[model samples]
Target: MTDPAAAQAPTTVLGASTPRTPPARLGVAVVHDLVEAIVTGEVQPGAVLPPEGVLSQTFGVSRTVIRESVKRVEEKGLLTVAQGRGTSVNEASAWNVLDPVVLSALVEHDDSLGILDELAVVRGVLEGSMANAAAGRRTAERTAALQHALDHMHETIDDFDAYSQADVDFHFTVMEQSGTRLAPTITRILFDRARESSRFVGAPAAEALRLTLEEHQAVLDAIEAGDAAGAQRAMEHHIAEAWARRRLPTARD
Candidate 1:
């Protein structure tokens, strides 16, 4: 990873002695543009990048900036640099898809490059299990907290941003109520990412919002009844339905 301190330092051109104050976020800007281009297929894998001199000219930055930016991409598993062959973009399969940078770049792309489908799988497995575990730990206080979030959802149905925050808090609260250490932390990151992209998989339509409430209510019901298997199944169904809704060209998409 490029150190923030180093990124802030004045960058010297390949042959120059004077330290030049780099443009604001020069390295990060270069990395983001190149990542979007690659992930969105404007630049394909196996294609060789132009030489650093050309990249510097193209981005209108110093040679040092180009190098640092390229280094950032390479570190993220998007590019490979060779002494004699220059830099080559790697296939998406080879990239570190789980890295927050890579995931955020994909999310920020026009359509997430279809990575949301993959996220659905991860959520289905992890959250379903979390829900199952939560059943054993469910208490009146925990149930009330979840119902409070759900109530917020109902009241803010006309406000998507508010509803989205409530939705995030609802699921993250579920994980916490599960009495697990890692699940909440892992889910917190993914939930925030999905929320940012409007990919939290809910909407304000009467049907959509009602369905969300019903689905969450089902999970809460199962937990309140102390049915681990039912809670797991309910959560799994909710996740699958959410994924299906997003796959369509509907508002949730």
Candidate 2:
């Protein structure tokens, strides 16, 4: 016969620990899939989700799973649930685009050009500020990292995908050197938009690559020389050139 008191003793001895078991939350994964579908416009705003019973049956899970998934989507501002009414998709503005799920949605939506342009504008502002700050605050190590990225860009000059990735890295490095949270966050968001655009992966114009490399060099030189004004101007020029290269049709033109 086992002693009830001995059996009741804590399994974890003072500091000795039991193996940690990972959480078993599949709700987040389900929520992400649904949210992604909505953001990509596969399920437009105001579109109702399948009934909870249907979702549970389809996913081979319980109503608790469905409810948890819906709750997660609601927290991301992608879903709306009511007592009598069903769950429906929310507007694009309701989403937190900086959230990775939202970013993926923006990329998946083929017609997200408008949002991409808006993102570019925001990026210009953020990167410009970061360049200026880096000019003033950059250490030797950060400057060296920028130079290395530039070298990588040159080496991959013939590879559009590689070159574009290096370009993103160079800008991100500058923002990191600025030692500020906001700039890095905004730069990341901008790069996410760029990746979604998918315009830089194919055969890019040689002229475009040359111009971009030169622009990056200019920004690097300005940052290295500690020329804040020059850095800001160079960054703005680089971004403007990229915008123009995208050949995005304006409302008037």
Candidate 3:
């Protein structure tokens, strides 16, 4: 006879219980701290981490936080855990460096690597096809968007970070203009991976940025002209030059 909502309310016994709140996440922050330490080799490979209770107390957080943090590092292949034993750091090669978080950690410590060359290889194949398709299929709106990104690149040339971001945008616009899901998806991944590696921040070697902007113009021109072959060639050449710049040997030898 009672209303369902009222009937469903808890009937508390004397001094029975209080409601519980879900634990807060100290996990992500804890994991990031450990990741930085590991990547920086402060915690050497095969080193065992302090026990969960110790870590929880040290960080003034719950054991749940410590457990979740360990789990995250394990997922990144940076650590291995065994029941009743402890967690141990893994070798650098074992980590998923392509994972954005891991890549950010790695790049924070060491910026001199050819990681961008690998990224450029993936972009070259996928983006070249996208450029060709865009040349054939681009709508006027999409072409204008691409041109706008190129213009922004020129405007931002004095700011390496801004120019790099605009460069990424220009490439992404070309992929989107292709009107294909796969190319755009791959291009996004490639750019994201490159950003994580922090490979695009420095002023590219003198003339490199200028050359890239010119190549971008070439691709835009071909796309506007509806010359599919020219667009594809221009895109391929741009990617090739990018890879070459990224792979140029250091003079430290």
Candidate 4:
């Protein structure tokens, strides 16, 4: 049984502001708060949520809004709603990490940077496979386009923003040449999400840009030579090493 006192959610925990969430977006606000609370461990796994009446009062929304919001959180694998026992947060392992809201919350709260580390590993594997496929499927035109992207990166090496974009262009060119739909889509989503995290965008030293240029050149050479195995290795090495160079050390490290 849940301790009665534990069920009383702090009003601030629900993100109740002085003005309160407008009725039009009460459900969304409630859901966002609940997810963040669960993800950040403000609400621990197996802790019962407050009763519907308490929640409605705390959030200043109707009981109906509370029910709907809780249901949405349950659907995201963050909550287990027992019929009579009340809703409880699930373990982090149960979360839908790919869900945009869940992913955003995880990234925002990732103080140790473990999530970004895992993100890099996943990107390296997926991008390596794509590079391999691109090598096999490369036509003269596709190879030329990739070379052009590499050239742009070289030209813009002094301009961080331009070089960063060109780097993305180089990767996109390879993914496009692979002609695989699902993998590219998933990779793009993960890549975009990681890029949004400041922890994943640590300051790059001038030497870092030079090293990146060298890495890109290696990948390009392997792909242009149609060395599928070599391309896969080059792409994987670049992603993993690039992330290592940028990853900020935490106390946990």
lDDT of candidates 1 onward, in order? 0.77, 0.76, 0.77, 0.88
- Expressed as tens digits, the lDDT of each residue in 1-253 for candidate 2 is 9899977765421111332221365676666667766765667898788788777665556789889878877888888898788988898788877777767666556463666666667777888888999999977888899999999999999887788788878888888888789778766765765575554233458998998899999999999999998998899888877866865454544
lDDT of candidate 2 at residue 179, scale 0 to 100: 79
Runs off by more than 4 Å, candidate 3: 1-25, 41-48, 57-60, 90-94, 152-165, 182-199, 204-206, 225-230, 240-253
62-149 per-residue lDDT for model 1 (tens digits): 8998899889889989999999998998988889766677777787773633666767778888898999999999889988988898
Q: Global lDDT for candidate 2? A: 0.76
Per-prediction backbone clash count: 0, 0, 0, 0
Tens-place lDDT per residue, model 4, 1-253, is 9878756855557544332544468899888888988998888998999888878877788999989999999999999998898888898899988888888888899999989999989989989999999999988999999999999999998888898899999999999998899888888888888888877887899999899999988998998899999999999999999999999889999
* Model 4 segments more than 4 A misplaced: 1-24
Top TM-score model: 4
TM-score result, candidate 4: 0.88
Model 3 TM-score?
A: 0.67
Candidate 3 clashes: the total is: 0
Could you tell me the TM-score of candidate 2? 0.74
Candidate 2 regions off by >4 Å? Answer: 1-29, 40-51, 58-61, 82-88, 139-142, 200-202, 247-253
Q: Is 2 or 3 the stronger prediction by TM-score?
A: 2
Question: Over the stretch 143-216, how does candidate 3's per-residue lDDT look in tens digits?
Answer: 88988999999999988878887988898888778879967875675567556543444447658888888999
